[model samples]
Target: MTVRETAATSSSNYLTRAGRGRGGQGQAFRNCNVLFHILFTLKGVREVASGQLRVLQISEKGLRASSRRKDIPDQFYMCIGDRQIHIGCVIVSRKRGLLDIRFLNELPTPFVGAVAALEDPFALLEEIRPAVFGLDGFVN
Candidate 1:
């Protein structure tokens, strides 16, 4: 299969694992935008360990490289599309190219919709966040 096909498959598998597959809650909000060329969905976001740490399940396209990184930094803002709102999260771990970001605060409900519609779901500063971690960067 081609690289794009593989990436799509990988993203699908991730959604399944997160229980946000074809007909899942995330599917309803999935839409296309013009930022990163990366199609993505917000699987879910919840607090862990008595609300000590907030975690976010995000599935994205083109993550075959960042999954191999040994160290992911902290305090990076996971920006949503071209909006000013950002969720402060740190990459806790990755599985099958799925990112499990640990957020410092619970993501606001309104922000979820914004993020779900983003073509480039993860941005940092003025650039796409994934590229900073050795991913292929934004497709757009």
Candidate 2:
């Protein structure tokens, strides 16, 4: 597969199979704009135990909000302490408490700098208030 196709697959894979498509349906809601709306809405809200919000589960309804609409790419955003950190590739290994995020070729330079500064992944949710409503608010 071409880099673009591979990236597309990797990104959209976050959502359930039903959510993968251009037509209006599934978790993606068949509208990329709607995805961003949800993302921003999420960001606008606040939470009490904001730590859970750190590990962004990239999917149609998750971090791919911007890319899904622009037809760019998909990724997971690790929000830590008021910072929305993007991750191109992530391996959720709960046992290790490590969300191994692999950066894609198209990632921005500024985002690279941000991920580099991350010292601990476990304390991310609390450190990075990625969601507007925060973790507690989102889950509740």
Candidate 3:
């Protein structure tokens, strides 16, 4: 099987094991389910025609980290305020603690809730961050 398929299968197996371990323990199960979603959520511009690229916030570090991922698509874009910024991809820089953003287009002024507004999206990735992260009870 292909690497991607293998990875997907492994991830599924891990999730199944986790779910089984929680085993209908109401609250614990619920928390685990929520954690799974939060951990897998992706941050980036998905579609412009649908206004789906509107990002409210993201950590600079996260942006950099994401840029470095080889699997990231080439056409990623982040819409900030009135301008649209096209980024090639993001890479995480451990030392700088910031997202190494490479712009295919000029970096624009981030909107009031642009992803570029934050220094680290995951730093506040705990359950208390916001509904956007969706981990509410997972971190705690």
Best by the TM-score measure:
1
Residue range 15-105, candidate 1, lDDT tens digits: 2333222222232233333222111223232321111121232333211123333333322444433423344444444576445444444
Error of 1 at 115 (Å): 2.2
TM per candidate comes to: 0.31, 0.23, 0.21
- List the candidate 1 regions with Cα displacement exceeding 4 Å: 1-71, 79-86, 118-140
- Report the alpha-carbon TM-score of model 3 versus the true structure: 0.21
The all-Cα superposition gives candidate 3 an RMSD in Å to the true structure of 17.0
Question: How high is the lDDT of residue 61 in model 2?
Answer: 28
Candidate RMSDs in Å, in order, are 15.1, 15.1, 17.0
Give residue 89's error in model 1 in angstroms. Answer: 1.3
Question: Considering lDDT, where higher is better, how would the candidates rank from best to worst?
Answer: 1, 2, 3
